[model samples]
Target: MSSSPLASATFWLLLMNTTWPSHVHNTAPTPRGCASRARGSPNSSCPRQRRSATSPDQFVPRKAASYYDLLGVKSDASADEIKNAFFDKSKKLHPDSNPSNPELHSQFVELNEAYRVLSKEPSRKEYDLKIQHSYQGRQAFGSTSGHTVYRSTTTNDNVHYWEQFRHAQSPEATAEERKQKKKRNFRLVIYCVITMVLSVGAHAVFFRKLEEVHNSFMDEKDRAITELYNEAKERARANGFKKQTEILRQKHADFQEKPEF
Candidate 1:
């Protein structure tokens, strides 16, 4: 019923790691009801919905870069064309070739991710379907006339659609993003505290050892000096040099007056 300290630490570490989200850039098809949600209308079979259902492969994300666009190729471009484009872009944006430039490195990563999805057969088909679905969704908001009078322009409709779509998605996405950011900051603070504690502990041990060594050296030096002084006194007494012995005794008595190591 009680966990050990190691178990508790491991639990927290795993929790921290588990809370981190995957950074994969792959996109999935927008749900079928997105258009109705975008328009704030109860009609599930709105014009966009009908059109999307009819041609789901025509979908494309309005806000995202298409694989064809990223690769600088036509939608109908061949696999070889995509490969060539990737090679050219990779050479230009590779991080090793452009050191200390983070922007270029990011671009290269995106490029590689795009290539990874586009280069595979099954993934390419899935990606194409999602792209078509997005394109059709965007088209769902295109200009429509009632009684030969246009209600809204394409640009205005698109603006309104995106506004509603963003409003719906914003709350949940923002909450998750904020939660992740706070978790990352908390992890960083924990790391800093641990580093500081270890550093202080190491310095304390080092200085304590240094002080001990210094005391031992000073004691040895003082004993050697005392022996030399005794030898000098005896030699002076044996030679009958009382004045020299007195001078040596006076100097030895004032040893603390001189500079110490």
Candidate 2:
């Protein structure tokens, strides 16, 4: 059947109105045509619509584990407790137990590292201190009212704890440090004083030995002079000259008074 021109024009107008974007009717700002087209439809340009565009799983963030939590142990767990817990966890996570699962090997590696730190007394103490600090930090910035407040540490954000936890000072630590410093200073002073005493004693002994050598040289010189004079007097007597012998003796006495080397 042939329709009237007025009816055909009215039908085209209704079709065009139905195809127009929904945001045009609203008072909000309209997005660009290209962005609207790229979004698959102009109705998807609204802020509410944009958020629902992606799946909820895409926004789900991953979280990292603390050493104590990873090992399934309390912060105050003893060395024996830590060891037992580690062996129990490691046996299940070991790669040999799950040969088909490569991921278990990685889990085992992390468990091994956790054990390595917790097994030692010193490292375990440090770890416990770090965990305490982390908990305190979390408490300080915990959620208040309707808002969740988070502290932005310089280290790994996902871990929720410091990777290289800084060593904190306590009363015992301070006293031990002071005691060590004092001991070191005392040892250094003692070493210096001992060195000084030894040096002074060495100098005194050297001078005493030098004085003894000088005295010995003087005694030998005097003895040599007396012997030479006595021999000269005896030679004069053996020649059968009484006056010459007496003169020689007199000369010997004068020479003995002042002899030159």
Candidate 3:
């Protein structure tokens, strides 16, 4: 059957809506780079997403030499050994010996720095403690990497790069360290005194109790012995009195019988 113009238009609109793809309506517009990528173009100037700074691949492992390594001595090397190593290296790296070489001159400067720290007992101990606690210091000194770089900076820089690793203690810092040491020693002495006092007090109480028990036992024994001695003496005296009375009675009987005869 033939329909009216309005009815035909309405039917056509409904058909078009039903036939359209659902994704075309829902999808957002593609970016220019995405469109280029979809076209498989090689010359597209699309920027790639950069890797994160914290990504493992972004980190390049670097090995650095510690002062001990620079001096060619072990970390646990004695003061004498460190001094001797510095002297030996100094002879080779001295500016006068290698006048033309700038590299040796730099090494001589490093050698002097190492000697200045390691030659003294206080600075060396402090450096050792720092290396033990620091991660970079441990990696530098602990690792056996073949390519080890020693960090250096120009003298114009506010602080030398090596100074970051080891620097001379300020007078204030030295005084503070000494103060801490004295405090620790004082605490240790106080602890010892407290322990000694407690021990002596415990011993005195134990000994006093022991003496009281011993005295009580001795007094009881003495009382028992005295009672036994008194009982024995009273029995001996009663027996002697009975014997004398019997003798007197026997003598009187004999005298009466003689007078009657």
Candidate number achieving the greatest TM-score relative to the actual structure: 2
User: How well is each residue in 1-261 modelled by candidate 1, as lDDT tens digits?
Assistant: 898999999989998777434443343466776754757465654444355555867775334456677778887788777777877776787667879886674455556666767766798999889777766765686533111212245575445434433321223444686798999999999999999999999999999999999999999999999999999778887767777768778889899688888
TM-score of each: 0.30, 0.39, 0.35
| Residue pairs whose backbone atoms clash in candidate 1 | 57-132, 58-132, 59-131, 59-132, 59-133, 59-134, 59-135, 60-131, 60-134, 60-135
Q: Give the TM-score (vs. native) of candidate 3.
A: 0.35
Per-residue lDDT of model 2, residues 112-195, tens digit only: 667767766788789778767766777787733222223334343424223312221123443676798999999999999999
Better of 1 and 2 by TM-score: 2
Candidate 3, residues 144-245, lDDT tens digits: the string is 534444546676222433452354323344467679899999999999999999999999999999999999999999999999999867876776977757
Models ranked on TM-score: 2, 3, 1
Score each candidate by Cα lDDT: 0.69, 0.69, 0.72
The segments of candidate 2 whose C-alpha lies over 4 angstroms from its true place after superposition are: 1-54, 58-63, 143-248, 253-261
Candidate 2 lDDT score at position 154: 34
Candidate numbers, best lDDT first, in rank order? 3, 2, 1
**What is the Å distance of residue 174 in model 3 from its true position?**
2.3
